[model samples]
Target: MTTPRPVDCWLTDMDGVLVHEETAIPGAAEFIAALRESGRRFLVMTNNSIYTPRDLSARLAASGIDVPEDAIWTSAMATAQFLDDQRPGGSAYVVGEAGLTTALYEVGYTMSERDPDYVVLGETRTYSFEAITKAIRLIEGGARFIATNPDVSGPSQQGTLPATGSVAALITAATGRKPYYVGKPNPLMMRSALNRIDAHSETTVMVGDRMDTDVVSGLEAGLRTILVLTGSTSRARVENFPYRPTRVVESVADIVPLVTEFAPVTGPEY
Candidate 1:
């Protein structure tokens, strides 16, 4: 067998892997620092389309974790990239906040409500029936449907709130058109992340707390994966899946040392 390359680039999930709401997970800050100090290319990624990278960076800072704007990636950014690739300088009828809108604008996309190239959906706390109606109408009018992510719900101080996927379902039920999702579990998102960083799958590692989205997508994208128990998944839950991550750890604290020096995890099964 050809020898595997060392872990050089890292793509990590942000919400469960780093911080939980306003609190930073133990050693997550150190893990970020270690990657930075090691000069490794890394991105703190999230599926939430509500906040821009700058906004997310500030939020992380509030939790005592320091990550720069450029080192962050979001579903909104990925959606914009996908749209830009598929139809450069296109038009869209968006139902999202500044993050999604700014990304589209930065990519030279014109926002239109009439005969748009696409009807883009994203996460927002203020979604209303009127907004859903508009999106459904646009889709029925020949606008291709697109969504930032497939997360059905998002966490808040109060509890879980309906997310982009839930709204997408509502629109689908009305129009019978399924949207192209541009975030995690799409493997396209992982490949896009790799392209954004100029990372080779052989030399990159994906660290996440979700078996369904993170580990699965990373695996399908031909990258090594590490499942941490700091978020949505636990040890008992790992066996529920048919596949396995290259490694499983309690948290990011276990990975701080691997940032600078890691033996490539390259088993035949992995």
Candidate 2:
């Protein structure tokens, strides 16, 4: 078995690991504050593409966790970056909220609902049949399909709502083409976040609640992964899973102490 390595930087998931449905988790704010005080560089990496970095930062601040705009990295940003790199100046027909639309626009990707070069899907609160129909039409008309993430649903204030993956699935069934996913569990998203901090895999650790997406993505990226049990994943799932995280804690609050003790000591002890 591979042993865990010390992390110079940390990448954290926002929803489950930090908070649940706009309510901050116990000790979460303090954990982030401690990290900030220690001068540790950490980025909030989220698969949710519904909010731009500024929007997300504001939301976090509202919840008592003061996060800067640039400290937050969303799949929307990753998707925009990917599109810019792959098909620069290509037109995109987007079926998502203001956040997704804003990111693409900021990146200079042309937006159109007809005869577009690409059809990008993200989580939209107002997902209507008309929206799906328009996306399907564009995709069938030969536009490349791109999805922000594979999350089928997400927890909201009311309950779980359909996520972008579900819409992408509908489009896939209609067009017979799989959309390219640009979120967690995808190495590109991880690489994008790491690039922001100029951090390497060996020196970075990814902390999240989901093993399938968060832990798996970090492991695939050669980064140490820490699974916090405050969200979707349960203790039972962790024990039975074939791929285990480098460390498993009850919540993000436990990370600093865990890492402090678990990280390798450099000098030889007397």
Candidate 3:
């Protein structure tokens, strides 16, 4: 067993660890407040590329979490950073919301439908057949493929909704090219967040609800991982995975005291 380090920074998932479907989870507010009050560097990460950071911030605020826009990091931002690093001033034919497109634009990427460098796929409420068709044609025309995340379905009050991975699969079936998914479980997304905060993986803790994505990615990135059972995975299911988190708790509420006890105070508490 790898010994856990004291937490100096944090990377938490938005959906399960902090909130669930527009509702803030119990104790989530206290945990975030602790982080902010302690002046510990942290970022609320999400794989959903449907909304920009500002949009997410506003949504979280409405849900009772007072996270600022800059404190949130999305897969869209990661994808844009990846693309910008790979090819500065590149062009892409994007099929996503303002979240993905805006990030790309900020990074100096141009939206093009004519044989662009890449065909980027992301989350959208309506996956237009016309856009998917365009993406397929572009990929067949020799453009590379990229997607924000591999989540096939997302939770909703009504039911499961087809997500980015499902749409990416459809494109793959036609083009025979798998996209480079840049979200959770990729490790790149974790690395990107760490870089954003200038935090080292050795001193950072990752809190998430899924073993396949959050725990694995954090472990690979050399961060202590915490699995919260407030969302998708259950207690019994934790053992099913070959890997395990540093600790497993019932929810974010349960971890607040642990964080307080373990977190080193960098500044005087208010």
Q: What TM-score does each of the candidates earn?
A: 0.96, 0.93, 0.95
Clashing residue pairs found in predicted model 3 = none
RMSD of each: 1.6, 3.5, 4.0
TM-score of 3: 0.95
Note the clash tally of each candidate. 0, 0, 0
In model 2, pairs of residues that clash are: none
Ranking by TM-score: 1, 3, 2
lDDT of 3 by residue, 1-270 (tens): 344457889999999988888889999998998888878899999999999999999998998888989899999999999999999999999999999999999999999998799999999998999999999999999999999999999988999999999999999999899999999999999999999999998899898999999989999998878888998889899889888787888889877886677753121111
Candidate with top TM-score is 1
Of candidate 3, the 10-residue stretch with the lowest lDDT total is: 261-270
Worst 10 residues of 2 by lDDT: 261-270
Worst 10 residues of 1 by lDDT: 261-270
Q: List, residue by residue over 1-270, the lDDT tens digit for candidate 1.
A: 577788989999998899999999999999999998988999888899999999999999999999999998899999999999999999999999989999999999999988999999998889988878988998998999999999998888999899999999989999999999999989999998999889999999999999999999999999989998989988998889999898998899988877756667554332
Over the stretch 1-270, how does candidate 2's per-residue lDDT look in tens digits? 445456678899999988887788887787788667767778998988888888888888888888889789999999999999998888998888877889899889889986999989998888889988988888888989999999999887788798888888888998899999999889889999999889888888888999999999998998878888999899788867788887777888877674444463121111
